[model samples]
Target chain A: MSEDKNDSFLSRLKAAERRSGLKTEDDTKESADDKDGQSLATLALRAGTEMISALIVGVCIGWGLDKWLHTRAIFLIIFALLGGGAGVLNVWRLVKPPPV
Target chain B: MAGGSSIDVLGQFELHSVFGGLGDALHFSQSPVYMMLAVVLVLAFLYFGMRPAAVVPGRFQAAAEVCYEFIRNMAIDTIGPEGASFFPFIFTLFFFILAGNYLGLLPFSYTFTSHIAVTFALAMMVFVLTVVVSLKVQGIRFFAHFMPAGASLALAPLLIPIEILSFLSRPVSLSIRLFANMVAGHVMFEIFASFVIMLAGFGVVGDVFAIGPIAINVALVALELLVGVLQAYVFAILTCIYLREAVAH
Candidate 1:
């Protein structure tokens, strides 16, 4: 009985292995190489947060610098723009098309 | 939720002392209690599950081995050969978060992962570890990554700040993602549960209508289960990705 169970388990494992191999084989080489289980919804969720967090950090730094320097809004203005750029850069990195 | 018409969805997240007056005196809350429980649970699982150490393996051993192999393969595959060195850290992190998430699904359990403070602390640790690893592996050259390979020298003033800001955002985004996902799932669960309670208050017809929300809540629980595991997987994979970049030098 135990032998039968082991044989069944082994066969099921082999079947699973074959299925996964086929799934990976069907993907493009680049995706297969770097695939880390990110689905579309996950990427979407990540991209939104990536952009916003960078902007938040940039604005915080800018605001702190302005306070330290006793400047009105010079540093704030500059850093906000920089932060916005950083946010775009982050989103770009996340959603950019895979390499050819 | 005691009062009619007040949803009180967010109240589920409130942290209060447990274990009677001792907890109040110590300022200890359910958060730490749950965290300790998660830690003990993970430890007990591995210890008891693997105590037999049979060659053929029992059902409990198989479960333990599957968890081990999943994290082991993920770390090695994502971070290359150097991943072996970081496997223990990654394994602990994955299992801890996984445990906390799964534990939260149980009625009356608090989820530490849902707290911004807890998630931020975890993310900051990962961020600091990656930075340390990069500095150790690549030395002075680690700073070079802030500037892209082909950027003009004149553009450094603009580009460097953006790059630095982008890097600084990593921990913030990582923390927010996990916290937000956990909080959102739990809040939705509570809101739907509230609907069932609220609807049943209206009488027999209301009781029949209340079944709708109950059905939805059941579905939401299933969704929450998937989200809990998926969020844990995302956190682990992102950690591996960051470590890969750090160790790539």
Candidate 2:
């Protein structure tokens, strides 16, 4: 029912992939996808959509809490900052340079 | 204590509280504790699941093996055979998150993954780990990943910066994807649950109608369980895709 037809040890890449459990395709290896290299900024911008939403939500929640507690925006500022920091952090994690 | 997003993302069964609480801080900040609980859960699962490695294999072992194999297949299929080495890491990540997720589904427990800090921290670890691996494997050549195969010198000026920008955006997508999904699922669970609880004590009509929320909650809990695994898988697998680019590039 199942088999290990393709098995090889490449090195760091292999280790990372295996750990992530994110298999793409085999056969030709990682070749087939040479479409005009997609720009890194494009993906980053796409991800920005999520970041922006998080920021708005964090800020609104914090602000609403401030309103509830009558404590101004103390939590709002912190949450907002955290939200922004998270946005930048996401960029740091995913985007990568193109292959040579 | 469970607030924010709630759909009972994991088939949130109402868990009996295992430990007494410390204070409001401990009660509100349930991430670390839940994570600790999840770790113990995994240990228990492995202990019971693998102690009797039989020829025929017991249901537990069979089930555990299936979990491992599924991820194994995912890694091999996504990352390749070299991915076998990552089996431990993937398994750990999968179980840890899975446990954390289910733990939150427990009644009155804080869902750590629902918190951005926790999710971001986890995502950041993966990001940093991948970078370290790439640099170690490729050496100085790793920087060359910035350049595309055949862009003209003129185009490089514009395209290269764009490439760099996207490269930097990984963590944003990675972290938010997990955090958002978890939070969203949980929120749905909460809203539906509140509906059930509020409507449950109204006598005959309320009692008869209570089944609606119960049924919905049950279904939601089941769906959330699937989502918990799905999110974990997506997070781990995306790491593989990004790693491929890092290593080969």
The number of the candidate with the highest TM-score is 1
Clashes of each: 0, 36
For every candidate in turn, the CA RMSD to the true structure comes to 5.3, 12.4
Q: For every model shown, what is its TM-score relative to the native structure?
A: 0.88, 0.63
Error of 1 at A51 (Å): 1.0
Residue range with the least summed lDDT across 10 consecutive positions in model 2 chain A? A33-42
In order, what lDDT does every prediction score?
0.91, 0.69
Q: Assess chain B of each prediction and give its TM-score.
A: 0.98, 0.80
Residue pairs clashing, model 1 = none
Residues B44-81 of candidate 2: C-alpha lDDT, one tens digit per residue? 98888988988898899998888878878877777666
Model 1 Cα RMSD, Å?
5.3
User: iRMS values in order, in angstroms?
Assistant: 0.6, 8.3
- Give a tens-digit lDDT track for model 2, residues A1-100: 1233334335556788767767545623644433223234335444675567456555666788799999988978866765565555445444655568
Question: TM-score of chain A for candidate 1?
Answer: 0.60
Give lDDT tens digits, candidate 1, residues A1-100.
9999999999898789777775344466658545555476678888899988988888899899999999988888888888889989999998888999
